[model samples]
Target chain A: MDSKKGMKRREFLKKAGVTAVAASTAFAAPNVHAKTKTYKWKMVTTWPPHFPVLGEGADDLAKWITEMSDGRLKVSVYGAGELVPAMQAFDAVSQGMVEMGHASSYYWAGKSPATQFFSAVPFGMNAQQLNSWIYQGGGQALWDELYAQFNLKPFLSGNTGVQMGGWFNKEIKSLDDIKGLKMRIPGLGGKVIAKAGGTVVLSAGGEVYTNLERGVIDATEWVGPYHDYKMGFYKVAKFYYYPGWHEAGSSTELFVNKSKFESLPADLKAIVESACARANISMLTHFESQNNKYLQKLVNEHHVKLKKFPDDVIEKFRTLSAEVIGEIVEKDPMSKKVYESYSAFKKDITQWAKLSEATFYDMNK
Target chain B: MDSKKGMKRREFLKKAGVTAVAASTAFAAPNVHAKTKTYKWKMVTTWPPHFPVLGEGADDLAKWITEMSDGRLKVSVYGAGELVPAMQAFDAVSQGMVEMGHASSYYWAGKSPATQFFSAVPFGMNAQQLNSWIYQGGGQALWDELYAQFNLKPFLSGNTGVQMGGWFNKEIKSLDDIKGLKMRIPGLGGKVIAKAGGTVVLSAGGEVYTNLERGVIDATEWVGPYHDYKMGFYKVAKFYYYPGWHEAGSSTELFVNKSKFESLPADLKAIVESACARANISMLTHFESQNNKYLQKLVNEHHVKLKKFPDDVIEKFRTLSAEVIGEIVEKDPMSKKVYESYSAFKKDITQWAKLSEATFYDMNK
Candidate 1:
């Protein structure tokens, strides 16, 4: 038995070493007698049709993935709710109902509060920090472990740099006025607000307008200038805010079913991840240009009334978040464990951010 | 006065109307500020010193900004906490104590529940969507409007594509196992976990290893293989997971004081933003190769144990998170307004992510 175990381990190492060599050769496949089989994948996302750079970003990923696989693998993308509702994407991929989908982790908050950890953190690390946690901070392993259970495989697809605060129907004045007010805030901030004695609401992408217009909710938070101006929010909400705390730096993903993912040739898997990574950077460049142009317009053409959150309100929320956060850690073991890890990561990275970005801005400003 | 306003508007329109013409004739400004001002800007980040990819990303931004400005914009970079604590970055920049800082939004939940919206939301848009919202979604307008009060300006800087889950001391069996667990989670996932009856801890990057080893946190999330492996978490944690739910696609930012940013030559501002944009993409590509190379070693050499999260835990979290997510929108009137605008944008653009990426992935996989 001992010999067999030793032999098995040795075999695994030998195969792995061979794989290392093969990989270095840029994915040249070993010759096979039989014809190679082609693969097809179904990818879904919550993004819209080819609208601008972002819409095109998805298309770009598809094009690159297909080409990278040398026509061996083909992917077809579906809009949100086409094969499954936007919210059901996790289940769709997990159940092998779809091959993959593009989304943000925060969207899956309904499944597990721990999921929020995978997306973005409130007052947490931005894209860089989040990336570190995921890439270097041991995030991928934890996420893979969590995802394997559902038969879902997730990959980092893209990122939107630190975001802007949301639009407001009324200007934020102080902590008192915001209490009990209705807003369309999502992610971890919702709980923070709840702790601050404020009410929170949720809705789908298509439904927020009517709700806001009809006074269903008093305020709403979204992304930044480019889309905000496109949506004509200035016409409805005169007061706009900046520096989103909830999202900070938001990330999107392409998730595939675990069984389906493992079934693919290693090269194909690499292709998909690589393609997604490419798209990730492409989206940022697209935003850099588009956001700049739209921002000039919101202020110049729209006659938009912009406002800021009151300092008192900001202070109040910051102070009360602990109550809400404490409950999360206290309520569940997994959450506590995840939280402990996250807190440490944040603390450690926090020291670095202080010197890196802070010093420059302080002096130059 | 109206004529002056009209003249300004006309000037702005001319610039936008024919970008090609502007691009062709826009002469580089003659170096006028002849003193060669050695302006020092504070830079802080969530990344540790010399950490490749993210750390280098931050450094790249500083280098590019300085060189592009002809050294007039000398930026002094400090690692996190070198200036102010990581969690206090927003306040540091907002209060003019620091010129700029790098961080994610969720960390600011303590400051404003609405701050969370600035970054990302669960089931929110991925990098593409987030960028669209920031650029065209009226997100920037709101962001700037909010930041105005804080006397700061934000420019999207670096990004990490999609992230991994985390490093775990043990394997996760099911969602139930998540209960009573300690995790270092951030952003929306932290809140969602609380909703799912789990404990979530906020942590920084540097501290995750010791916490996990010491049993301070059962699991810790950092970045992907390239970084996590470098950080040596595999030595302590046996299991690694995937499918980060917190951050989908995240982007970092270079924060500057409003007056300071405005004081710069338009070209300098443009240079800084553009440089950072390039850095964003560059970092993503760097990480891809870096992570892949190290991942093999983690498994082959380190004998790292890789595991997946149980389906039960993922499903349970998904089911319970709806209630948690719903709470964000209920507070504050403005959040609802922003959500309305964001929804419109999401509805319009989400279809694109599907038809392209979703289709290709589905067929290919």
Candidate 2:
């Protein structure tokens, strides 16, 4: 390196004389290759634009990819409804309405029901453990296998870290208080809530605030403290709870149409994958970091009282969630296959986390 | 707390009747209360794990310390060789020589220098830019950061990334000539030599290869595949080379000393950071996922001609590498910052690396 050699590599280049733009530009720019190629792709998203974390994550992905490839591959990212209502992104991408999509699999439960296992399951894997299950533990390969049936190659693109329980219109005093509450819940948690005697509804972020404000829904969970505060849910409901069990560690994805994806040249394909990989890690920490600042603002600035869900309520949800998950296993073959593997891995990882992470966390200095 | 709602937060545990863990085994459970505990600390790193990415990264005041206690505490990690032999890790922890040590930092860049930057700096970035610059510019914080740092805290850890073209052995090739030149390489890309020009030497996979291989370091650069490979150069050299600059995105990290880390209250130290954010994109993937496969078959299944460097050969290395990079920077500060930032961070990171890491890897990535 620079430590030993007498002459610098940059100096050697100065003597030879090449330019900076050349350095930043893709090496293959103005390709002298006999054949020139360009790729045009459409990407649909689950989040709206410039919404900071989630939405911006998608926009940034598209922008960076275009720049990196030097216009060889062009991708236009359409926000939630710009392509399809946010929840519909999965099917649209799967059906090849677009070349790609940025979405959370939990939103597609109505389509396959089994897809929720990939995104999150109540009492499921945490982000790290989930990632391990997916990437290192045959989850991604199986996900690919499942999506292939739908003409899709799914990539884990984003994560919401562990989410917060929804904002509620009334105090969730006890397990018996949930009679006919309508909550915007999705994925496995929705089923668990339904089991716990709440009417589960599904809607996008842009709609949640209005619904909660209008009393159309008594409660709603939309990401974490940062976005929830932004949506002003605290103004409508003060009972914000901890431990989001529904979509814990929710992951977003760039679901590429298999046909279109299979056709790209090697370099461009690599570019797409790398870009998404960056997004995946970036999205998680982005939320974790930003949410801390925003949560303080929510309580200190907005006067939202943070409260833990009463134990009986949580206990009931846990019990019902377990039953709901079991029922899911009895109903879906894919779910069963996934759960079997998922739970097996979860057990192994839980043992480590309990011993390593749990112990350290419990005994304070 | 898991205790029932009727119980007070403190006595809540007894009321719940859940068994309490004995003090001797306390470092293994999750904390129930958050945000009000202080943690004293020590963290050991692999960078000597003493400095920079290997040490400093581990040592940077715990980001969570402020958030957890509303700003009452901080913990630090030490570098390798600070308390024990760079390689004698099992003994160090078992004996509690230090609370924790930074993770791998190249599984002990002492074990192998060529792979030291697996955490960072081939043609890497300065520290600040690494924290933000490289990641947004297509370098995710965790790419090889944690895996190369230790095995945990991927994003929290960082490598300088590809180092400068390392010191070398005799060289000079039409680029294709670096066949059968035995050199020590660490991490994954050490596996990619056919294109760059070299026959890699694989020993027990540690830092020792750098100097010991000096008699054999034909024209080595381990990091830039350029620099690190250079560091492992052949002894009594004839030709020197350039390029290996591709690892401009390498990283390094501070492995937190484990016990010190464990002693922190929940939230006071969230060791898991925002770094693990995932993306749907992939990169150098062809090399990572595909070419690696072919390169293997060629090297193993078919046994293509493996090579070493020849002097007329490195003449080209010294030539094209400069041409390739100078063309990259030309005169732009953005390019310069990109370059300067990487260089600067590398310099700062190295200060610590030199005392701890350099001593280890220089002797041992």
Best by DockQ: 2
In angstroms, give how far residue B346 of model 2 lies from its true place: 24
The TM-score values for the models, in the order shown, are 0.49, 0.52
- DockQ for model 2 equals 0.02
Query: For residues B1-365, could you state the per-residue lDDT of candidate 2 as single tens digits?
Result: 11232134225434544332121122111221221233344555444542322243344334322222222243454455666664665335434554444454445434333223334433343222344333443333433342233332223344332233343444344555456665555433343443365666554324445444445444444432212222333333333333333343444433444444455443323322321112111111111122223323433544433343343443454354444345445743333334444444444433322222122212110
Q: How good is the docking of model 2, by CAPRI class?
A: incorrect
Per residue, candidate 1 scores C-alpha lDDT tens digits across A76-192 of 777776777667778888887778877887788667667678777665566656666776667777777767767787777766655666777776777766778788888778777
In model 1, what is the error at residue B174, expressed in angstroms?
A: 61
Q: Write the per-residue lDDT of candidate 2 for residues A138-228, one digit (tens) a residue.
A: 7888788778888998887777767777788788888656778899987677777777788988776778888888888999877788677
The candidate maximizing lDDT is 1
Which window of 10 residues has the lowest lDDT sum in candidate 2 chain A?
A: A27-36
How much TM-score does chain B earn in each model?
Answer: 0.83, 0.42
lDDT of 2 at B56: 38
